[model samples]
Target: MLVVYTTTLFMISLLIIDYSTYVLEYPHSFKYNMVKNK
Candidate 1:
């Protein structure tokens, strides 16, 4: 049971980190593009 719980927690955190990276990078890329065009 403990092993299963830890594995689930690790997977959840990995997903969260991936989501955070994508979310943070998306706006940064858009902003960078806007600045470049200006």
Candidate 2:
């Protein structure tokens, strides 16, 4: 159970890091998509 919890947390952190990097690289497109989604 501890291993599973650690693995899930690690994956979530990696995803957050990746997403932030993407947003930093494409702020305009990200914003555009957000507006379009609405």
Candidate 3:
């Protein structure tokens, strides 16, 4: 149970890091896409 929790937390952290990097690298594009989707 502990191992599973740790793995899930790690995956979530990786996703957050990746998402932040993407937003930082393409802020305008990300905002544009969000507006378009809405």
Candidate 4:
């Protein structure tokens, strides 16, 4: 039971970090595309 709880917490934290990274990277990606167009 403790193992299961710890795994769940780890997965949740991983998901949050993954989403925040994507949010940050997406803007940089968009700017890169805009620059390429010009």
- Candidate 3: give the clashing pairs: none
Off by over 4 Å in 4: none
TM-score: model 4 vs. ground truth: 0.82
Q: What TM-score does structure 3 among the candidates reach?
A: 0.69
Q: Over the stretch 1-38, how does candidate 4's per-residue lDDT look in tens digits?
A: 99999999999999999999999999999999999999
Local accuracy of candidate 2 as per-residue lDDT tens digits, 7-35: 99999999999999887879888888999
On the 0 to 100 scale, the lDDT of residue 29 in model 1 is: 99
Task: Report the C-alpha lDDT of model 3 over 1-38, residue by residue, as the tens digit.
Answer: 99999999999999999999887889888888999999
Per-prediction TM-score: 0.82, 0.67, 0.69, 0.82
Q: Which ten residues in a row have the lowest lDDT in candidate 4?
A: 20-29
The alpha-carbon deviation from the true structure for residue 6 of candidate 2, after best TM-score superposition, in angstroms, is 0.3
Q: Report the error of model 2 at residue 1, Å.
A: 0.2
Native-to-model Cα distance after best TM-score fit, residue 33 in candidate 2, in Å: 17
TM-score of 1: 0.82
Q: Residue 9 in candidate 2 has what lDDT?
A: 100
Clashes by residue pair, model 2: none
